[model samples]
Target: MPSAPSVRSPLLDRFGRVHTDLRLSLTDRCNLRCAYCMPAEGLDWLPRTELLTDDEVVRLVRIGTMRLGITEVRLTGGEPLLRRGLPGLVARLSALTPAPELSLTTNGIGLARCATALREAGLSRLNVSLDTLRPERFAEITRRDRLADVLEGLRAARAAGLAPVKVNAVPVRGVNDDEIPDLVAFAVEHGYRMRFIESMPLDAQGAWDRDRMVTAEEILDRIGERFALTPIGREGNAPAEEWWIEGTDSVVGVIASVTRPFCGTCDRVRITADGQLRNCLFATEESDLRGLLRGGADDAAIEAAWRASMAGKGPGHAIDSAGFRRPARPMSAIGG
Candidate 1:
């Protein structure tokens, strides 16, 4: 017999933020070695046994939507496409009562191979990481010559009918900073929304310097050189500050995570591939959901733990404060 629906309060923090978005990581394994995310040789991956089983992922997500008020779910990863049985997992996630909106973030290396299957399986949207359009620059940044594969994956994703296929690019000062205009142009031409993110302090190398990051102001200036920009005010807790390019219906967004923090309105929580619950992206502490799930705890216990974890979420990431510290895990391991 089917279980009755759970009636519980929404996931709210002491700061009065209601968490409605969940960023769930399926695996800590990735195919690319992006310069900003990982070292040339990637870090050690979690053992397969340590990862949350597909059944476990569904149960937790079910608790989130049915018990809590989570309405949106984005599957992240070192690269989510690397997860086996991805389409089947998406199908299960989509079948939940009050089914949350499903999205995926990927480097788009082999997305061409599975885009249609993923769309048919209930993926609602996609965000592809593409730093540069130049093949040589792409190879230099990623340490792999897979630019062609990524481009093809973008096209395949669009053809698969994924609307608003967002392209996420990080403009490193000495690397792809000069290509900002080109990147925006390409996105506008391709019917994809372009998002330029400031290089954050999440790399495995811990070499992030504020001076090397391309600021949001500078990004808008670069785009202004080629096209006039009209500010499109942000809606809700969205991290991106968007702008409309004159003469076209295309829009571009900038995530100034460092210079312009948006923590006051943050409404998202994360679950690592190994089942650690994080209230914030830069949170130092994690609540052990994996232990609870494996220890035979009931749904009520898991719900209590999840809510308790969010209660301790700090006011903000505090990247600019002197007391700020980077997370122990890098971006790749932390699911981007």
Candidate 2:
């Protein structure tokens, strides 16, 4: 006879966004080749067998939702859409106890094809990473000529009733920095919020020129001329400086990870597709939870492991102030 499994109680952050908001990376695979993110050359991706099965992920999330007050879940990937049957997984994760709010972050290339199914399956919201709206520039930035596809996907997501969708613009100084105002305008017209994130040192394998970095404060200053920007409050779990323009319907957020560090309010945790628990995105160390999961550890065992990982989290990363060099892991390695 099989033994009964152990259970973990609900978890919460200091900011109260339920520490259960799991960033479940489905695969370390992506199709786009953005200069700021994935490498131009092909990467050595992990084998398929090494990935967590869809069922396994759903089960883990379900347990978290039931015991640990997990009310929100965001599915990310090297490109989440690359993983087939993703909507099925979304449906599964959406049906969890009290039910988690299901959302996803995608480059939007494959989203047009999957948006309808995703909406039907219980996806509540979406955040698309769109740096440029120009066709040629889109190809130049992402190393892929799929701007049309991404735009179509955005339309589909909106039509599917995934309201309040977000667009993330990672401005890398001279690269897509000019697109900031364009993105803000687009967000205003479409009723979606756009977040401008300062480039960080997550791209380990590639050369990360911190000198080419553009801080969130700079982005806000540039756009302040067109729209009157006012500070907005968050639940405190999010690290972005939120501002809303009075006349426009859109909201702008600045993720000043490099300039204004918010690690003190860092309460989120990341779980790789293979189950390695990462305390901080910029931290070099991570704890192994895959072994424990595969060994049939009970819920209490899993909860204890989560607590231990949380305890090990550093106060914050010093790459910005300490003049530290970039780490070895790429941005893709750190999910969306």
Best by TM-score: 1
What lDDT does the true structure give each of the candidates?
A: 0.92, 0.77
Residue 4 of model 2 has an lDDT of 48
Q: What does candidate 2's lDDT look like per residue over 160-225, in tens digits? A: 888777888888888878878888988888877888888876763566787788877779877886
- Separate clash counts for every candidate: 0, 5
Off by over 4 Å in 2: 1-18, 321-327
Q: Model 1: residues >4 Å from true position, as ranges?
A: 1-5
Candidate 1's residue-wise lDDT over 256-326, tens digit each?
99899999999999999999999999999999999999998888888989999999999999998999989
Best by lDDT: 1
For model 2, what is the C-alpha lDDT against the true structure? 0.77
lDDT of 2 at 223: 85
What TM-score, to 2 decimals, does candidate 1 have?
0.98
Candidate 1 at 115: error in angstroms? 0.6
